[model samples]
Target: MEFGTTSRTSGKPGPRRERSPGGSDYAVLSRQVQEAGLLRRRPVRGVVLLVVTAAMLAGSWWLFVAVGDSWWQLAVALPMAFAFTQCGFRGHEAGHRQTFHSKRLNNAAGLVFGNLFVGLGFGWWMNKHNRHHAHPNQVGRDPDIESGALVFDGDDAPGRTGAGAFVTRHQAGLFFPMLLLEGWNLHVASVRALRSRHTGAPAPAAVEALLLLVHAAAYFGALALVLSPLKALVFVLVQQGLFGLYLGASFAPNHKGMEMLSRDERLDFLRSQVLTSRNVRGGPATDFLLGGLNHQIEHHLFPSMPTSALPRAKPLVRAHCGDLGLPYTETGLIDSYRQALGHLHAAGAPLRAGG
Candidate 1:
């Protein structure tokens, strides 16, 4: 481990747990939590995500609007902010599909939110995310967990010769811009994938292209017609930049590095959920900014469960972990963010050709 990082084995005094809910105990664990009578109900979570999304939209609009004619820059900025949240919210449920009982309804909602904010939609994401979850530490196949794929290797094999060595060391910082302009990155990736004839390019790539153009036109043209150019651009910057940064950061923290255990090591969903992730407890700010993504372990275990209920539900996870002797790691927000940055920085360590 790097400086300021400690292994679960070395930390504390008691025996720590690593495994999650097993087959036979699954029912017992659920029964324990359910019997507590504190389990968060479903639709309540859906309603809450929607409510927060609405409040963000409303607050941004009302605040800038209150400023009157002097501040058109904000006009474009605020709605895009909301749009970003809407995108995240959609994916949140799609990942778990716990928000709605109907898979079709969840997928439809995910597609609308994702495309509106330039995401890959539920179907496309599932392909990537599912593989990632299944083989999280595999160097090439795990698209979900970013296990140093962009980072360079110090000790290279004969095949990774020449410039590939230098490229690895510099990838971390270089990747920041891509994270910032992820919407563009997503489009570009889609283009390349389509051109290379990758499976599931959403049929004929041209439709995707046209879809992109139409989305751009609708957002820009509407802003131009209704608001001014200045506000429209600011809106894009705020929502596009901050929203991307936050969402991407949330992802980065979840699985940057805990253990490079193989998919086989992850014998079950619960084990994968706990070993592959950690969380932050940022108090009230967590609810506002992250939608309580601070509870990633709990979220992964009960993916179908809604976000609003995560904080409340996390205790159950902690209790279960305690019983199982799991090393439930919890760091403050700043520390957690620092850990993610360190992961990126470490991944970019430079190396020479092995061959």
Candidate 2:
């Protein structure tokens, strides 16, 4: 048999054509984000979360008042713990454009959430977090995690060493105390934020400084007038500590060590996001507590989409990935945490702030 021209349809390249701007494929799965439930969009609906948070804050305030005795104030601020956590949640939703459709409302909530408590910085977090969504596993870019400092093999980020490493190695003892002083982990990025352009604007920075100052002055001023200093300290401790744990866990589990992109790690941004990010599957508890963050793939793809609608979109993502044969990792909440721990253990060095 003699070989002749093969059929083009049989795995042959088609005729080439001119490409359009950005050279991106026209097909896209993106949907314009909608508020969780429209028609209820307003200051009133915004309170849906604050309603829960308010009750908790009020109860904590009342309890702190009722018990001005020995160690009891420390024992009873549990409701306030929820309030602080919700404070983070409301701000997180604002960042995602899921809390309320109104940019002003969300920004206000985020600003308060940022500076409302002891250690939060809304401006810094919004920058890093939004970048994380854009870059996912891009090694040089994703600050959602500090992959530590030293790089091992191709993927491992071996951590800091020497005295700092020694401290990180023995970090457990310091966890509670550091958590206490820092106002949860809210202040974690504020210092770095100060030197950057984002923090350069005198207006926002002054606002940030004032918020921190007022945050301090108000609590201390309130303490001097009414409660004992020791009791006020305790209030800060419990709320900050619990909220810190929530903050760390909420973020770390999403993409601790899936696959990191290098400075040279070349990938299409959209593809990399799908490759590195995973879902927590879903459940009622995940929905309420996580504000539907468990829908990681859907969240990354359609970030502006209200978190509640992620469920509606999950299958669409899974289907697309299924077609592409790309890895789309998912696990339960506990399992994801376990995976983060595993990533840490494999790194086996001390954690650095930007690792």
Model 1 spans > 4 angstroms off: 1-22, 25-27, 34-41, 51-79, 117-120, 145-149, 152-167, 170-178, 190-214, 223-239, 263-266, 350-355
* lDDT for position 333 in model 1: 71
Q: Write the per-residue lDDT of candidate 2 for residues 66-158, one digit (tens) a residue.
A: 776557656665666656666777777777666776777777777776566534677777887887887776656776545333232123433
lDDT of 1: 0.56
TM-score against truth, every candidate? 0.73, 0.76
Estimate candidate 2's RMSD in Å.
8.5
Residue 243, model 2: lDDT of 64
List per-candidate RMSD values in Å: 5.7, 8.5
Candidate 1 colliding pairs: 16-325, 17-325, 17-326, 73-231, 76-235, 77-235, 152-168, 169-348, 169-349
Misplaced by over 4 Å in model 2 are 1-26, 31-44, 117-119, 147-159, 167-185, 199-203, 223-227, 349-355
